[model samples]
Target: MKIRFPMRASVAACALCAATTLAPASPVAALGPTGGGPGAIVRPEATVPQPAVLYGEGTQVRLRSGAHAVPDVTALSWVVADAASGEVLAAHDAHRRLPPASTLKTLFALTALPAFPGGIRHTVSAKELLGIGEGSSLVGVVEGHTYQVADLWRGVFLNSGNDAVHVLAALNGGWEHTARQMEDKARSLGALDTTVVSPDGYDADGQDSSAYDLAVFGRAGLRDPDFARYCSTARAAFPGTEGTFQIANTNRLLTGADGVAPYPGLIGIKNGYTTNAGNTLVAAAHRSGRTLVVTVMHPQAGGHAVYEEARALLDWGFAAAGHVDPVGSLDALRPVPRGATTGAKPKTAVVASTGAPRPAEPDWTQTGTIAGAAGLGAGVLLLGLRFRYKRASRA
Candidate 1:
């Protein structure tokens, strides 16, 4: 159903998907199959970071067989981990941070999801729209449109819209404040590799994240049912002033929009790209009883290189599940206070990251007071998938 952007006498809708993506301008160390394209970041095998879990004999044999051939894109980095146990199964340049493109939205969502409630409705403002960067992707939000908190999230996970994120950030507080909260949240999740300058992940001067951290985001986000639902929705009618339009997910693995088939048992997570970040993806899948998350970054652009690499890793992870031993853990959500809960259903264990500011706005559940009634409604807050040689994703 459409979130219902009323076609009343109000502001008109303009080109929504006109936003642009960021391009990597700097050079860094490279790690690729053919040693990567020219000037690609390369790190020696000895110096490259390793995952927490060491591969077992079965996994080692799988790698040696080379029959599946790990994703061959150069400067490509990835990690595979168990969703339940926090065990890292395999990794390649897992900690080397690079431009994250839209994948950074995962952290943004984590930091902001709790502030607004699903039924909460908010109207767009010109000042809020001003912050969205040109050339960034959007879901066609008109300036005068009134939308539900749920509608904005659909724009985010489904279309990877810069507009949707901006609206949420504005409703929470100010752009700068929301961003500061996100950065602090990253360190608490142990995703220290991330540096978020732009919330929508449009390559800023120094925005970066690691495949390892992405896995952490995916695993952590999935713990929430709301996050899981948004990622799993393949297509939905995004709200608009005149009418709603069907917006499909940017994640091709889940949609099977490209040559790839809908991965069996595939869920949702996220996928992103920028000239700088190349094509990046974070996916979750379940074959049997085990759920695995895979994050791949900076694979060759224009082809399904990122997804293929992630799938190969998934292949190994599932086979290595019981066979391989974990080298480390994906840090648990900061523990909750002894008596204070995070409003999470089933009571998931998560704590606010140190130094992060809690939004002061009132939510639908908290009170009838609406966000944006007062400067972004103070004190309010709340808050991919690709591939496989033959695999799936979770959003």
Candidate 2:
């Protein structure tokens, strides 16, 4: 079955395989993984200040009188922004890069989730499960067990399992390929502060992200239905060798586990902890049709600080909306034109809740050819695997 690309498409459809993917450089494409070489797309330089003037080292918020001040917390980096309008309400060291821990999985899910359909089943191989980080969390996915793609995703969200991530990466090609794709996706989203050294968000020597970039990920993930569902799920049944077992989400604020009081209207994005990264969280909540996303990274207060800080920010954001102007924006920086003259500065456009000329839409005719062909190739491979999986199941 052939797929047709709709004009003004949010995602592109490949003619060769009945599938759609982020169509090249579309706005949605900028938010997810694409089928392209790691360096195929030119990105803004990391040093280039995004949302202009967001590089300031201290807190950035213009509070009017009678509005309570944002809570003082020990987070090294944090940001709170309007999800729909992309207006950053307040931020502190928003661009400061720090270790990301498992929170990097948000980017991973954005990149890899669309590549596999949930009903597709993949058998775990010993080799596929190899190279999981030592001391990393596991979902107890035994080798030789076959799992519906959905089950593995549950393992990832609920248990933060590196083993499940490895299996999914193997399906997407391999760890290195998925990591490179993640890097490409991050740049596409204008998350310039993140460096993807590991696809599973394990603490590698240089893997890192910043509050601004992480909030960007959370906002983008909400655009996808599957990404939203998986993260918000509080519990799920994961298949194991012995039997199916229940796993609860590690996001304390979402599940109200670990003595943390659940925040009303909380939406699960992700949470992470590692010796190097400390505690990191990306959380979103909706009240009165307005949604806010918050990112807290490497808080010094320890235990529950990440969740509490995020909760406090959300409260402040909802109340502070319209009372304050955006400190910055979450809009992705425009990519350099493919063959622009060397050293030409890329245009820095900011999308705010206030009226501003939005960035120009990418010319799909010019860019879609390459992305469509790439999507076609990926679609074929995935379809073949699905057919094989079905045949094996029926045998």
Candidate 3:
């Protein structure tokens, strides 16, 4: 189905103006418990505090004995983490960088989710329909097809579609803007080692990430309800097309009826493969109410081998830890050392120097008022000019 997207100048202008107006308010709403604005949250400690029993001498020996070993995994690296607690269950070259292939699309989908309006209908442009010819997979989105933003998300996760990624990038702004946004989003999410050069991971230079970073991205992506729904689909119909396109999930474990044995609670995640980065898989599984995420890159065998290794690691985790919750209540644990007492009256600040009161300086309200008036005047003049131009063209 062909779709034509009509870009109305007035609508675009209004959207830009609205975004500019609301941008400042966003930071205020992101404030933390300390009442500091966005980006002011206290940094997490570098090392987790281990229990005295666990930290005692020779405890490291016990940890080594309990470590799970992966088989047929040739990747320079791998990482398995607890989804709930964010604990590293296993690591083999986890920090080593490797091409993520379509797995990078997971980051792209997540970073763009907040920018897109839910349930909004967007027409696919001709430029977005053309797929990169670099041997990457595509969902066959044709030019001039109108679809909801939600459907584009399905294309990204279900089919690992490069074309769907392009459409999403265009929807956000463009390739350059989308790439920068992806980097910023990754940094904000604390995936410090990640770098995204392309919206679709198509073997582009500098477009690589570590297995550890991919696992982090997967965990964050799974948190979104829409993203989880799209990735978990065994099959879905692509709307606005001639025939219903059957999308088989790339994760093979989702295909089998018997739910990947030994693992017992495998949930859908993502898979990727390329010459530079051998078969890569990010698998998530749940058992006894605890969820674990495993990432394998450049596996010795195919994708299935990686899945089997992940299943083994998950089994070991469940057997050993037995669903120990990682997080604890801050209030129940310890309190900050600030002078203000908990639930106490606000303390008044006393100036050390004794001096006569000076007249308060003139407030800047008048200057601000003048600036606001000038800005309003300029907006009115621009609108008048646009209206006049439209009227003249109509005449």
Candidate 4:
């Protein structure tokens, strides 16, 4: 069963153009919060670390007496958190802003998904395909082909299709409008680090997100029944000019493609890579009725380091759940209540936090058994079935 939402159309007129031609790649100067020297980033109040400790440059974790050490990785930034409670198990530079690459699609889906339902079909117009970046990934969307909204989302999730994103963005109003909506949505979700210059998440100047914000996007996306279905879809037949073609999910952990073994109880979220944002990933899995979300960004080591590090973090997260206390929170910040005439500093809601002191150097060798939230799968399936029945009855 699949579910979709109603989309508002705000089509802009433009002469039909040719399908996007791949152009020669030029080096993109890294230019965002990350390009600034260290300490250059001035975070929004919403993006500030909930617990003071999350501000540290090194790994942050508070383990109980018996808890094993967290797996060490070379990720520039990463976060592991419970999807249900919003408890951050551990993180390193979680709020340090950096390029997000295609993983920013999670935020895109969060913003635009509900407006375009699965059953609604749109005919692809050449105008809608304009402005895709040179050297961008595509899922082979062709002009004049009519496709279900669901099909386009499959292309987005499985192929990281920037073309599909542009078409959908056009439908949502236009590329710029969709980008604005994504930015607004990010702020609403307390993802203050994100700056959306391209709705498709093609690298643009000043566009970046932190591991904390990406995990926040992933956790929030999984809560939506439609989003859960789309992200979790492993493979599907995509509508094409010739006919339907098969597209498999690019998330290595979910599909076990490219020698990365399929993670047990793994559920899809998103993955991304570019010359700048090397191998960013956001993954969630369910085990023993608990759901865990992990985000890894720009590991220093090249070649599958992102996925391996994410997997290792997941292992440590599940194993450390009961043993380690939450160091911070993924909860969005809210206005702190203030008295009209009081001269006192304002404070946001008190987030759950507890942890032991960090070791001088993490013991990466500590091994532990672990595992995802099972309830969400059941809920998503039931919601999809009910929505499918309703749509069928209407048909």
Worst 10 residues of 4 by lDDT: 10-19
Alpha carbon deviation, residue 33, candidate 2 (Å): 48
lDDT of 2 by residue, 1-395 (tens): 64533332322333433334443444322332336655354343332124765779889886776777888989999998887767788899999999999999999999999999999988888999888888898888888999999999988888999999999999998999999999899898888999999888888998888999999888888877888889889988888787888899999999999799998988788998888998999998878877788999998896788888888888899999667767788874635454434332232111123223245556667566757677677667567656766766697
Per-residue CA lDDT of model 3 for 72-184, tens digit only, reads 44555676666655666446665577888878888888788877865998888788656574777877777788888877778888788888888888888888899999888
| Ranked candidates (lDDT, high to low) | 2, 4, 1, 3
* Per-prediction TM-score: 0.68, 0.74, 0.64, 0.72
For candidate 4, the per-residue lDDT at 267 reads 83
Candidate 1 lDDT, tens digit per residue, 59-165? Answer: 21223232343444443677777776676656677777789888888888888987788899988889889967778898887898899999999999999999999
Residue 240, candidate 3: C-alpha displacement in angstroms: 5.0
Name the lDDT value of residue 59 in candidate 3. Answer: 11
For residue 258, model 2's alpha carbon misses the true position, in angstroms, by 1.4
Quick one: best TM-score, which candidate? 2
Question: lDDT of model 1 at residue 238?
Answer: 80
Winner on TM-score between 2 and 4 is 2
Candidate 3 residue spans exceeding 4 A from truth: 1-72, 257-263, 322-395
Error of 1 at 380 (Å): 57
lDDT of 4 by residue, 1-395 (tens): 75543321111111111111112222223223655675454443332235667767888987889999989899999999987777788999988999999999999999999998889989999999999999999999999989899889989999999999999999999988988999898887777889889877788899999999999899888877788888888898987767788899999899989998999988889999887788899999877767889999999997789889988999888888689878887763422233223232222112122222111232223211100123344445556656766877799
Model 4 CA lDDT for position 388: 68
